[model samples]
Target: MVVEIVQDKEIWDRFIDESPYGLIFHKWEFLKIVEKYSGYTLYPCGVFRGDILIGVFPLYYKRNMAFKAIFSPPPQSGIPYLGFVMSSEYNGLKQDKKEVFLNQVVDEINDYIELASPNYVSISTVSNFIDIRPFKWNNFEVVPNYNYVIHLDEDLDSIWNGFKKNLRKQLSRPEILDLRLVPSEDMSLFYNLAKQRYEEQGLTYPIYSIEYLEDLFRVYPNHLRLYYLYYGDDLLGSITTQEYKRYILWMGNTRIPDNIFGNEYIIWHLIQKAKEEGYLNFEITGANKKNLCQFKTKFNPTLEICYNVCRKDTLGKLAETTYQKFVRKAG
Candidate 1:
């Protein structure tokens, strides 16, 4: 087996499109956007056995005066998870064979890591890529995060019946029903609301700039959806969703107060839209946050755990500890 940098976009994206574990986050175009907006250098690597391509891993390199780091699906890019995109051949392998193949991939990754010699390396694997034991064995720190996924293949009535009573009540409210669900191009409004939300929580706003969002919309128009809840001329809230293989409720911002319950209305509308669109799953990403978990649980979605793997050198470890301490104190 040999691993080398893949420069051909068609080859890279073909593997991603064919893999069951692939996501929109792993697409070549998305990585270009990430690199362009975040100003990070991208390394697109491919592993081949003999002459056949078997795996692809994309890494972003970041450097500062203090440290150098590499991330797979880097932070603040609206990407939930991305690590390795393996071929379908690996997917069908028996457990023992799968382990052997995975180890080979890890070996290649380790070789690249040694050559790059970054202070830190972090990778978040897709939801379906659950065989992260190889990474664990390699001394990477593993952190578990939760996401809520509603299986949308079932009958709509059955799905609706699964919602909590209060959620159902909120969805049924006449005021909510009267609000129009309209497609929106107002990213500035979305950014302002998101900024206000972060300020309200006394935390720094983490979203990318309006320019970045606009560029993302331009690049992946079919994959992205932006919707707003409006009562005639008054905008109440906005929700952004992405459709890859499944529907994902990526981010949302609301101008309406809690008592107004505009969020419930907008979410319900999106859920129904997902059902109509024949998506097999609707994911409410990042159910790890306390308040978010509570709110998303009202829909009776299944809990899915995703993994973030990190490996750091001495300096990187110290930096991580200091960052954690600061966050704890701030919280």
Candidate 2:
């Protein structure tokens, strides 16, 4: 197939929108934001048989600033997630013939990379445990990404029963708190509070900047929102929601202490809001392996495993191995 890059948004959006099995990442809105914010460069190559598009590989180029001066322009950051969205099932290419199309698409991408001579390329959140071919690009590296998910399909009564005693009491005593779940217009408050807590704990806040949140608000106001748990004038907690077809991902959350705001109450209210919006599932950003898993089980949502796909050089791999060995020996 002769591949061509699509420059027109309308055509691309129409094609992906009509697809049966689609992911939010493949949607035009997401690509537009990534393109707008990152602005490295967009190489959206389409595999077409004559006039019809069969597959597309979207990628962006970025300089490796950490290793700057060591290599010119360095390696490109990555495509974010081009491979997962390639199948015809997700992009209106051809559903029944997905395997054949996928293989062809992968080969074409590899060939394209070689021809273009990009220093490095990678994809993220491609779960190695559940994906079809976890690491199709033998040359890249792989990392495991864990995301905490709360199952919501089960009856609420059954879910309520599973919560820890204290959490259950908190939910039962919701009337005790004067907290209101209000749609927040100002994200700066939440960002500053979250940043402050992170600084106090000597940690980096793991999230996009306030500017990106504002951009998302402007772009997808209906599908995404910033909700706050407010006690009169004080903002107790805030959460960012990413609404997709079947699930509402709790992208981020921040809270202050004193228990006056009720952290659990904020979560419960978010759940109620998601239900009201007709979402089937809610995801809590994952923490560690044990406590988070146990905590999320109270919600009774199905466990959805998330993974990170990484690409490491030979020396980097060796360094990782040595670090792991040192930790094990220390233990």
Candidate 3:
């Protein structure tokens, strides 16, 4: 297989859409938006066997006078995973055949890494991409990350019953309080809430723009939305969800009046909505963080693991250590 920058948007997107490992994060439109906001150059790379594309890996490269960095989802993009995804047929192949193709793809990726020689590299592989040995073979370090998932195959009642006792009580609070979960295209309200709350906490949130979200909403109306929690006419809080193969609690699930139990109310309704729409799973991302794991674990959902494969050179190691010290001290 030969690896090169894929230029045809239609071919690349079609392959990604059909791939079992593909997520909305793998799409060209999403990557373009991420590139603009992250200030990284988008590289939609492809591995092709003769005339057919076998895999696509969309990466973001950042270059400056001080350093060069590479990321799949990019830092601060709020994307949980964005790595290479294989073709649909790749999944049906026998184990040996699959590894052969995967090995070649990883080799090509390594070749590119060698040529570019970025100081640091990180790739958060999608949940379905289980084989990390190929990447590990190339000297990448594997770090485990977690995401909380609610399997929605069963009926809503069964799903509700599976929640912890305290969670059931929390879910019931909304019914008595007269709060409404209204779905809307109001990206402005959600963005304002997120931006203001982060500022109030003395945190900087420059990862996304209103235009970036607006563009995403415009491009994928069916796949992304904002659900506002309203007490009569007053907005208590809001959340954003992304619907692809799985329904993802994408952002804005916090900074609400904690006393009202608004997060529990809105997210419960969203889970029901996702199940009704035939989604097989609801993913409450950010479980890797201690603060989030405590709150998200209340639902009694299954904990899932994903790999963050990373590598750094000598200078990169020093830079990363310095960056980590600054972050830890600040926290």
The model with the greater TM-score, 1 or 2, is 1
RMSD of 3: 2.4
TM-score for all predictions? 0.92, 0.74, 0.91
lDDT of 1 by residue, 250-305 (tens): 88877786666787777777888889988898888887789778888998999888
Q: Cα lDDT for residue 221, model 1?
A: 85
Evaluate residue 250 in candidate 2 and report its C-alpha lDDT on the 0 to 100 scale: 50
* Residue-by-residue lDDT tens digits, candidate 2, 183-223: 86687887787767766765555444677557666776776
Which portions of model 2 show Cα errors greater than 4 Å? 1-3, 15-26, 47-56, 64-83, 86-98, 126-129, 158-166, 174-177, 203-209, 256-261, 287-289, 314-331
Best by TM-score: 1
Superposed on all Cα atoms, the candidates' RMSDs to the truth, in angstroms, are 2.4, 6.1, 2.4
Name every residue pair that clashes in candidate 2: 141-310, 141-311, 150-301, 151-301, 151-302
Q: Of the candidates shown, which would achieve the greatest lDDT relative to the real structure?
A: 1
What is the alpha-carbon lDDT of model 1 when measured against the actual structure?
0.83
Cα RMSD, model 1: 2.4
